[model samples]
Target: MDVFIFQLSEFAQLVFETTWLPLVIWTVISFGVWFFLQMFENVHPIYQYHTRLALIFSLPAGLLSLASIHYISDWITASAGDGLTMITVISPIDISFTQVEESSGIPFMVIVQSLAVAIFFSGMIFFLIRFCMHAINLKKLRKSLNYRPISEMTSLSPENRGLALATGKNVQVAFLNSEIIPVTFGFRKPVILLPDTLKSQPEKLNLALRHELTHITQHDFFSHLMVILTEAVFWFHPLVHRLKRELVEYREMRCDNIVLSEASVSRKEYASLLLELIPMPNLNKELSVNMAQESSNLKKRITMITQQSKTKPIPKQTSLILLGVIFISTALAMACTDMQTQNVFDEEELDLMTNIDKTGEQGFHEIIIYMSEEEQAERHESKLEQLRMLEPEHIESVHVWKGD
Candidate 1:
């Protein structure tokens, strides 16, 4: 269990270090561009795409670049000549659970460092538990809902055929008892769940139906899960919310664009349907995108629909340039990150450390000797002989490494 917790903490630390810098860079770059372009119009749609791209790609890029950095660093450290052997250190871990020895006085800075690590692991564990709970609730929600075949809904106008054409696959429709949220669910056999109240209102139902279908066509559910997992993993970071907000806002806008492009559906009618479905006080599902949302988000959706911009997507060449710049910059940022301390000890070295009688020159020599991987195999044989022969004052100058 100790090993398990130690490994879990290490994984959390790896992801935390990997993500924060890239997340910050993504936020700054996205916000900077948003500010620059919005000097023309405050709600310029371009930021939506900028936000989308940043949220979508930055973390994965950061993770990849971070991994590359560790690999390269290891190779460089290992390939160093005979003068510098790759050493195995047994310093205090960032997420250390064991009490520090009385001889090693814990410093103020070490307390803060350890506290930060505790908070990180705590946040990751908390979100992981929350994610599982939501998953179980979603499972029950699916079972409780009544499902019907798409064929049963013949009231759909012929105009909806365009919407059907939009979804190349057959989609199932389900009815829920509560929640006005019309959302898309499932990836293989995609289903859209609507409020049972929409049954009598075919026109409004058709609008809602087409909107959900558009989400299915785009495979928004997977992206929704990806963003949720990202947020869950990095719940401690403030900018994650900004990235998530961009992702959610742009997703709806892009879907709205697709839904509008398919037919002659008036923007006003679409906006009205959205207003009609405004959620009462909460949302109940996860891993799904719904038609109705909170009022503030709804306002943005309405604005985008009513005054939908003529701005085109960032051009492919331009997008490539931007992506390339982010890629290089992210790699460079990972390079600048400070090297992390690692502690790996064999049983023999552990025995040396646990020796409570160890003090002064003899104890210190055993510790440094263990640090040199090449000399670790010698154990204490040569060191014991040298310790017995030499006086403490006769020893050469020692290099004492300061550890946090």
Candidate 2:
């Protein structure tokens, strides 16, 4: 148990040390993208949507890519006949919790790291539980749905004709008897639910269908799922929640754009439709895209719909800025990880690196342990002998042999 705790502590410390800086950098970059969009008077919603997603996903993707490359590069260098391998000499004080307690007690830093890991995991677990519960509730709701074919939906005007054809052939539609707002969800067989109230109003029903179908055709359900997962992982980051809000806002606007671009309704009519809609209680937000999800952003959505022309292609300046932010942030993160690999174990107090002879053969090393008169070397004789017999190919850190 002690060994397991020691190893866990070390792993936690390593992960924390390597990731904290990158996370900071990524957060700043994410905010930069967000703030940049806010600065513009009329950035396209699709552009905003894609950019935010890129920022959200870049951290994990960048970290995994860089960490893998760093590991592989180190492994290759260590395997070469003339490579200088890094050997992190672990001190007894670093790993021996019992011995440390017997002496000056467990290190404060170790305790803090353990607590941080515990807190992070606890929060993550809490969110994951919430996510699962919501999913189960959504599943129950799905089972209760009395679905009807899109063809069977109430009267469709000539302007809204063929809009249903644009959606996936297997898409299902239903009307909930409750007063809840419209929602679209599901993957293998996507489903859209409208309030029973809308059933009696054919014009509003057609407009609602256009909006929900935009979400269905764009696969926003999976995108919404990704946002939920990001929230779980980055639950502590305030900016994550902010980005989520921004995503929903832009996503709704983009759907509005698509619906308007189809020329089904005039800008004035769409704005009036948005104004008439009110926020209704949603059952499972994470599992479904509620049409009125952005009730708070309704004014902004209406303004965008009325003012903006047809959706614009991304501006070159916006694209360049996004690329620059991603490139620089990723480079800095990789540098930090590399530096941590090289210097993580080089402590001034332990003097672990002083024992290594760098002047020796390229792929070989000698680690000499100096003991005080109060300490007996004989206690570690077997361990020393074992270390002496090991070859470069057998060890992960590579090429360490004990010296007389």
Candidate 3:
């Protein structure tokens, strides 16, 4: 048991140290790949498809990296040990698979099954919490927005003029009691709405309408719903938050481009109009409509538009080279599992009974005691109880070893 505990602890330490570099490399690669894919195009069909693929591949890549670490550790230990009997001790339990027929105590199948069950329960708890939060948010959004019916017609108010043109329908616009939110709700027959004050200014109303209509044309509400779900599912990853922010910005940029292209408005003119209608007093109320927030990025948006040119085409060879590099990196990471050795010990020849007092004196006193399994178990239990009684601040760690 003592030998097993020592070996298992060493194995865990080895795995952690060996895998740290590879894990860091993979994390950076994954983030960079995803970021570049996002920046290559605004929220278009191709960009969305690539983003989904990146997300799907990243999960398995992360899991595989972790598994490779464990596999490497186990392989090294097994190789080094050769044919000697080995056991692994995890707290009170000791697992030995070296001589399965003779020992008949703890089977390898039992350990694997137990681990699977624990993982299953942990995953269930995580998903349950995520689903509940999403359901609550959906209910709140439905209750907060009042839906008004609409049919075919021409522009009604200045606020919904852009929406009418974009949807190709004279949609009815509602004045929600809630401030500057212009949301489209309901299925089959959708309704668009704006704040009552927005109807006064023609310029402000036009800009607001363009923003909202962008939402309708792009089905941005549905995109937002998908983002929210992804965030809930991956609440633990900081990258998930980063991805959401990037997607929101891209969505807005795509819509802005569409609106500007159709209106044939130069960057300066559109930017001037955007600044004038900047929702100063009602900025807080406009949070729902302006997903990116009214910040300095407004200037960046104008710069992007002013500098926009035809996207440079990538050569097929360059694309192939990039893909090849990614594949090679992944292969190298996976290959690390194949080059490990195992651990070994000779129990009979070592004469554990005689070597009981052979502890080398260093900084601390070392003691070795020889005892039967029953006696050793009792001693271990006693020591554990004593350690528990000690104040956590005063106690460090206790190490135990066995004599043959």
Candidate 4:
């Protein structure tokens, strides 16, 4: 169990350090862009595409990002140490740059400055490309959709009547006033507009209006928006996509729960209303309205509603214990698995060892040797004898070398 926990912790740490942070940042940025786009434009195809793209690219990009950090750190350290010092003969791999008050020819500062400038320029170019796509999509959405105030409608229209019945919360609904195609707009105020034909059915209109209103009252639209944004940001993560899908399904379920709670209508009646309002083939693709699409989830939603009475509740203590276990397990898994500090050496010892100039041109480098009892017995040599091997005449100097 300990070993398993340790391994799990290491894996968690690696994920957090490499993928999780990057994915989180990417999700935030992607969601921010999507939110802004939704405010101005109908959901852009590019936004969806970008979300999928981000999920696809997240893992590789995360690994690369981590690698880059290590590389940059090494590069920075190396570049900081330009040639102010001469090469004292030591290991062929060992190279050190020393600081001199005055030195000529390509200082470490210049090298680091050049590299920093290049990185900055590269980042700017990437940002420009990203911004351009967002700008283009926003421009197109503005052309397609026109915003109107929610309070303009005096009576509930057939299109919005269903929404009014479904939600108890006070909300406004509106539609984009466009002859080309109707787009649904939602936010603090939501709207659903219909063509002249759809407004005639009083019963169907009530059901449809109730459905849309349920979306607003339960904040289904916003929950979906959050999921979509999350999906976009985590485009590189399969788990994120799965989670987003689950979140959407849950949102629908919650909305259904609300509808069931308020209406007192039989399950069959509600289901029948949903089926009756299935728009014609031509109206299927309209973006403004949430539809009873996704047949698989629809069945599940119906089943859940039918079985709502059988739902069981777990004890509070059990829930708390489960949460605590998960938290502790996750923390332990991360701690044991972290690679960075796994082989940590004393920094002072490492610095002293690395900086030691072994060649005689610098000075005689003293190495203090400590031995285990077994090692001392195996060697079986006095300190004097060891000193004599280097220089017999310097034997007396050994005691002098020791501090008082």
Scored by lDDT, the top model is 2
Candidate closest to the true structure, highest TM-score: 2
| 78-121 per-residue lDDT for model 2 (tens digits) | 57623342333345322212323354655677767677777888
Candidate 4 local lDDT, 1-404, one digit each (tens): 54444454555455444444444554554355445644753222223333333333343344455566657756875675532221111211322334545646454544554554445456556545554564465346545645444334444554454445445434543343322122233555565544333345544444445555656755545544544443444344556665455444444554555455554335666666544434422122222335454556667666665756632332335533543443343333333322343223222333343354433234344444332223332332343243335544322224223221
Ranking according to lDDT, highest score first? 2, 1, 3, 4
CA lDDT scores, all candidates in order: 0.62, 0.69, 0.49, 0.44
Q: How close is candidate 2 to the true structure, as a TM-score?
A: 0.74
Q: What would the TM-score be for candidate 3 when compared with the true structure?
A: 0.45
Question: Which pairs of residues have clashing backbones in candidate 1?
Answer: none
TM-scores across all candidates?
0.65, 0.74, 0.45, 0.42
Question: How much lDDT does candidate 3 score?
Answer: 0.49
lDDT of 3 by residue, 211-257 (tens): 66666655555545555555554455577667666655655565566
Ranking under TM-score, best-scoring first? 2, 1, 3, 4
lDDT of 1 by residue, 1-404 (tens): 54444555566566555556656665566566555544654443434444455544565656676678779877876676444544443531132235666755444544554567778778888887887787687678778867876756788777666666667777778876765678776776777888778888887888888888877876777767777777777686665666676567666766676667654676777888888766543445455677754667777778767775443443435644665675466545544443421222243444554442333423333334334444644544443454455455634455665431
Clashes of each: 0, 0, 12, 21
Q: Which ten residues in a row have the lowest lDDT in candidate 2?
A: 92-101
- TM-score of candidate 4 on Cα atoms, chains taken together: 0.42
Error of 1 at 103 (Å): 3.0
**For model 4, what is the alpha-carbon lDDT of residue 121?**
50
Worst 10 residues of 1 by lDDT: 338-347
